[model samples]
Target chain A: MRISIPVSVGIFLLLLWEMGCRAWAVPVYILPPPSEVLCTALSQYRILAYHGSVTLFEILAGLALAIAVSIPMASAMFLFPWVERALAPFLVASQAIPVFALAPVLVVWFGYGIESKVIMATVIIFFPLTVNLLEGFKSCDRRHVELFRMMGYSKYGTLKKLFWPWALPYFFAGLKVAVSVATIGAVIGEWVGAQRGLGYLMIQSNARLKTDMVFAAILWLSAIGLVLWWLAGIMSRRYAPWKDRG
Target chain B: MTLVSVEGLKKDFDGLSVLSDFSLSVDRGSFVSLIGPSGCGKSTFFDLLTGAIAPDEGRILWEGRTISDLSKKAAWMAQSDLLLPWMSALDNALLPRLSPKKSDRERAMALFCELGLEGFEDYLPYRLSGGMRQRNALARTIMFDRELILLDEPLSALDSLTRQDLQGLLVSLQRDFGKTIVMITHDVEEALVTSDFVVVLSDQPMSVRSSYELIGTKPRLRDDSYVVGLRREILDMLGGHGP
Candidate 1:
C-alpha cells in the first residue's frame, strides 16, 4: 500500500525529466527523456525482449541446476552423519572464493555462451541454498524427535514428518536470497563478455553515456529479481503456512 | 493377582544410582499411587513399568508377559506430557487409537465428549490450558486398549482445587473404565484419596520406604477417616509433622 506514494513520486520525477529535456532541446542520444526512452523501448522491444529472455533463462537454469545439486547434497548432509562431518570444512571454505572472481575463468574455459553464465549463477547462489537448508535440517525439536523414536517411527518417517518441515522455512529463505544473487550472477557473466543481454546493453549504453538505456537495463534486473522473490514468497505462504496458521 | 511386577530394578545415572532394587506389584485393576518426595525414584519405577525406559538390572512382568511393547499394553504420560503442537485436542487424544480417517475422527469426537473437551476439537495444543492439555493427554493414552497408564505427576502443575477436581474425575473414570493406573505424586492426600495402594518412597537412591492400601471402596473418599489417617501418616513419614 505504501508503494503507491513512491510510485506516484517516481512517475512525477519521470514527467519532470521529460519536460526538462523537451524544454532544453537536448539531443535524444545524450540523455533521452521519459518519452524518448519509452519510444526507444517500443521500437526495440523485440530485440531487448530477446535479450531479457536469455537473461531470465540463464537465471532459471542456474536456479534449477543449483536446486538439483543442493537438495541431494543437503539431504546427504542430513542423512549420512560421516559425510556431513567430513564435508562441512570444505563447504565452509568454498564460500570464501567469490563467484565474481571465478566468472572470468569459467568464461575462459566454456567460451562466450550460457554455460559460463549458468555456472556463475549457480556458484553465486549455491552456498546460501545449501547452508540455509542444512541449517533447517539440523534444527528439529529434540522433544518431537524423541516422541517419534518412542512411537517406533523409522528414520524415513521422521524425516518426512519432522525434518522436512523444519528445513522448509530455511529452504524458501535461501531461495529468496538466491533470486537476487541469480540476477547479479547473470549480469556479472554478461559484463565479462556477451553478444546480447540487458547487461551487455548496459555496458554499451554507459560507453555512449546514455544513462536512460543503462537505467532501463537496471530496471529490468530489479523487475526480474522482484518477480522471482514474489514467486518464492507465494510458494512459501501457500505451502509452509504453519507460522501464519499458528 | 499381580498385574505388574518390578523386581530388583536398579537404574544408574553415571556413578549415582537413582533406583536400587525397587520392587512393587499391583493387583489386577488396582489403582496404585507412588507417594514420595521430589527426586525419589517413583518416576523411574513408573517409567520401568510402562517400558518408557529399560531398567539397568532386573525385569518387569506385565500381566504374565515380560514387559514389552509387542502387545501394546502400556502408555506413558510424563510430567511434561507432550502433545503434538500441530494437532487439536481431539486429534491428540486419537493418536494411540490409530484408525481409518472417518472412524478415527468419530471416535476422537466421542472421546473428547467423554473427557468433557468436546468443543475444542480443532484447536491446537498451544491453544489449550494446562488442565485441558492434560485432559487431552489422558484421553490419548487410554484411547487404545491401554492396560496400564503411567501418570508421572500429571496434575502437579495445576492449582490445588483444579488438582482435586481432576483427581476426583480420574477416580470416577478409572472406576468406569477399570484402568490399572500407576501414578507418581508428592502429595500424600492425593495418593490417599484416589489410589487403592500407595507406595511411599525414600528421598534419594530411592526404594520403597513403606506401603499402604487404602481401606476404602471406589467412588473414593477424600474425607474418610482411613483416608485422613493414611494421609497424615504419609505426610509425617516425609518429615513434615502433621497437625
Candidate 2:
C-alpha cells in the first residue's frame, strides 16, 4: 500500500502530461510526449543500450573508486588529528573549483578517454563520502569510546567495532548523494569530449533537434541514478537495522 | 588480601585540582563504596583507579605492582548504561570478551536469565527499559571475570525498587563470587546498604574526609539498630555535623 500510492501518482502524472501535450498540439521537438519518448527508446534501443552501458560503467567505476579511496583517507584523518588538519584544507579547496570546469581539464590530462570520465566522477563523489564519514567518526559517542578504552581494546579494534558500526549510516547518506551525482559527473566528463555514452548522445541528438531521443537518454540516466540510490538504501538498512526504526 | 591500592594520588584538569593527596586501599573480595556530595571527584577517583586517566603525582598498585604494569583486570560500569545501541543485549553483554567463544554466549544467556532479561536477549539497547539496560550493563561488567569492579553510580538512575534489587545482586556477586567491588554513590544509605566500608570525600580537590565500617552480616539489614545508628552518623558527616 505504501509503495503503490506514490507509483500510482507518478503514472497519473505521466498520463496527464501525455494528454496535455497532445491536446495542445505541442510540437514533439519542443517537448517530446511520453509516447514519443517511449517509441524513441524502443526504436533506438541498440544505440541507447551501448551508450547507457558506457555511462553506467563510468558511474559505477567512479563510485567504487571513490568508496575505496575515501575509506582509508577518512580513517587516516580520523585516527591522526595532525594528518586531518594538514590535508582537510586542501580537500575543501579542491571542492571550491566547480567540477564542470575541472571536467575539460580532466579530459585534456587524461586524453578524453574513459579514464577522464571515471576520474571526474571519482573527484565529484569523493568529497561528500569523505566529509560525511569523517564527521561520523568524529561524532562517536564519548561513553562508547571510554568503554572501549577501559576494555583495553586497541585503537584499531575500537575503529572496527565501535566507529564503523556508528558511522555506517552516515557512509550510506554520503553514498546516496555521491551515487545520484555520479551520473552528473560522468555526463559532464562525456560532454567535455567523448564519442560514446548518454551525455555524448544527448549532445548529438540535441544538435539534430531529436528531442525524443534526448529525453530517452535522460530517462536512462535517471533510472541508473535511482537504482544506485535505492541500492544505498537497501545496503544501509541491511547493515544498520537498528537505525531503521529510529 | 589487599587487591588494589592507591597512594598519595593527585589529579588536575586544566589546572583545576580534582583529587589531591588522596589515598585508599581495597581488600580482596570486599565491597567498598565512596559516598559524597556531587562534584566531589568520586568519579575521578575511579578513573584514576581504572587507569583511564593518570594521576599527576601518585601510584596505583594492582596486586602489589603499578596498575599500568598489569593487564586490564578491572571493569568500570558508569552511571549511564553504556550498552552499544546497535548490539543486542546478549552481544553487548559479551562485548568485553572480544572474541567470544560458544561458552561465552552460553554465559551471556545465563547472565541474561540471572539479570531478569532472559527473553530480551535479542532486544537492542534502545528496546530495553532503563533498568533492564543497566542490568545488562552490570551483566557485561561481571561477564569479563575481572577481580575488581569499579562502578560509578551504576544504580543512580534506577527507581528505588530496581536500585534495591541491583544492590542485592551486587552484594551476592561480592559474597558468592568474591569479586572486589568499589562503587560511588551520592546516597549515603545506598553506600551503607551495598558496601562493607564507605569512604566519604569532601567536595573538590577530593580527599578521604572520613570512613565508615559497616559492622554487620551480609546484605546489611535495616532492621538492625546498629545499621540505623550508623546511617544517621554517616548522614551527619555528609551534612557537616561530624567531628
Local accuracy of candidate 1 as per-residue lDDT tens digits, A83-137 = 8999888888877877678889988998888888888888878888998998898
Please give, as one word, the docking class of candidate 1.
incorrect
- Model 2 chain B TM at 0.93
TM-score of predicted chain A against the true chain A, for each candidate: 0.84, 0.94
**In model 2, which regions exceed 4 Å deviation?**
A1-50, B68-71, B102-106, B117-123, B221-233, B239-243
> Model 2's lDDT to the true fold?
0.87
Judged by whole-model lDDT over C-alpha atoms, candidate 1 comes out at 0.77
The 10-residue segment of model 2 chain B with minimum total lDDT is B66-75
Per-residue alpha-carbon lDDT of model 2 for B199-223, expressed as tens digits? 8888788888888777777777765
Fnat of candidates, each listed: 0.04, 0.61
Model 2 agreement with the true structure over A66-114: per-residue lDDT tens digits: 9999999999999999989999999999889898889888988997779
User: Which CAPRI category fits model 2?
Assistant: medium
Q: Once model 1 is optimally superposed onto the true structure by TM-score, how far is the C-alpha of residue A109 displaced, in angstroms?
A: 7.0
Which candidate wins on lDDT? 2
lDDT of model 2, residue A158: 97
